[model samples]
Target chain A: MNARGRIPGIRNQHQVLFYALSTCIWCKRTREFLEANNIAFDFVYVDLLSGTEREAVVEQVRRWNPSVSFPTLVIDGCRAIIGYRPEEIQEALGL
Target chain B: MSEIPREKVEALYQRLYEEAEASGYHLNPDKEFTLGLVESLLINEARYGYWACPCRLATGEKQKDLDIICPCDYRDADLLEWGACYCGLYVSEEVLRGERPLQSIPERRPPEGQRPQEQPARAPAVSVTELPLPVWRCRVCGYLCAREQPPAVCPICKAKRDRFERFL
Candidate 1:
């Protein structure tokens, strides 16, 4: 829905809203990969946040894939790639 | 009583003691380590023998040795199905009299706010103000577990499901 008579790209510009635990090795690795690639992304620390905040996150994850897992990678507005594998992520995002 | 030297057990006990101390736990290193060795030996014994004793000891309602409970029980129950008690004289009496094999340590705490199981999300309707407040959508699949009601176990993949980047 746009003046251009075409669907607009998602307004959300960030590559990911990475959810992770501080002690979890994989979550840390995912964050490192995003930083190294210079991809600006949102990060949610599930351990530190309150119950309500956590609930919000769960709702979001469910929307993307019924089978969503952690270290979810959100692309554009509607696509999600779960877990962290740089090459797999790149391929999925066509980066 | 077997061929395993007492020195080996002592060394292991010493290392375990150091770890406990470093972790800020006040424990009698020799005693705790010996108990640990005994527990391991008992596990081996269970595999080979037909005898199995209760995993924990309790007096009336109080319990002890929360650590040895299976992780499954920790995550599945509402009340901690296990924890340690500190009734000093009673504990000493029991131990000295050989009535209690495992001594009570302090209760092992879970990470803050971590319940055994994720509470079932309530279907309470969000207010209009809350409406369109923000819903995090996953990028992997179009799963929506819900916000303002964080799903403990993601209904989809059972991830510690949480918010995603919001669209609006």
Candidate 2:
């Protein structure tokens, strides 16, 4: 019910946070790729947030991606891979 | 899945395809993928008051968002450099012909602060200076018109008049 969405997966090796726009097709692909690979992750639809909540989330994303592009994947609080980069996702999560 | 209807998505897809073709531009040949982006564009148009690019997060204010409209200000450059636009909706002729693969591209539009300010109004091009009317260029599709004001809608890409900038 909250802005953050969680999907269950058998693999939990890395803490994955995905910042995305609900209207972004690449964001949809990124979610589907995770689901297909059974990679657990938390996602936020940045476009759906309003007011201060939106501002805070935007700042969080900007820290990881200066462009604030959709489908930005932050892994284990260490590295961020921007765009729907499936290979990077696979390598980062070891999926 | 989004609540937007399949028929509505298909209709816009058709319209865009026709418009792109007429303008010597091409759309992605992947129907399902293109339709998904089209659906998002519709979602944005309904939510925001204009057809915002599906991939970019819109601030929901039409004035601040004028550059990122569906056929965004960067579409032509992105299409030339990457073969596909930022959203993969518009593709280059090579991509359409399968000579090149369409893939995810880095965002070309810089962050808000880093964006280059619009250039100062320039003197009219010397060759066209004698012409009576001023020229306006559509930032989206590069359509040019000689008139007192930019067209209310771009005849080629259908972008709003605000997307136009003085050319000469």
Model 1: per-residue Cα lDDT over B49-120, one tens digit each: 311112221111111212212211222121122111221111222333455443323223343234222234
lDDT values, one for every candidate: 0.40, 0.87
Model 1 bad stretches (over 4 Å): A1-14, B1-168
Per-residue lDDT over B1-168 for candidate 2, one digit per residue giving the tens place of the 0 to 100 score:
578898898898999999999988888999888999998898888899788888998889886677788889889999999999999998999999999998889999877754322445566666676779988998888889999999999999988888888888
* Docking band of candidate 1: incorrect
On a 0 to 100 scale, what is the lDDT of residue A41 in model 2? 90
| C-alpha positional error of residue B142 in candidate 1 after TM-score superposition, expressed in Å | 37
Chain B vs. true chain B: TM-score per candidate? 0.28, 0.90
Query: How many angstroms is residue B147 displaced in model 2 relative to the true structure, after the best TM-score fit?
Result: 1.0
Classify candidate 2 by CAPRI docking class. medium
- Report DockQ per prediction, comma-separated: 0.01, 0.74
Interface RMSD of 2: 1.8
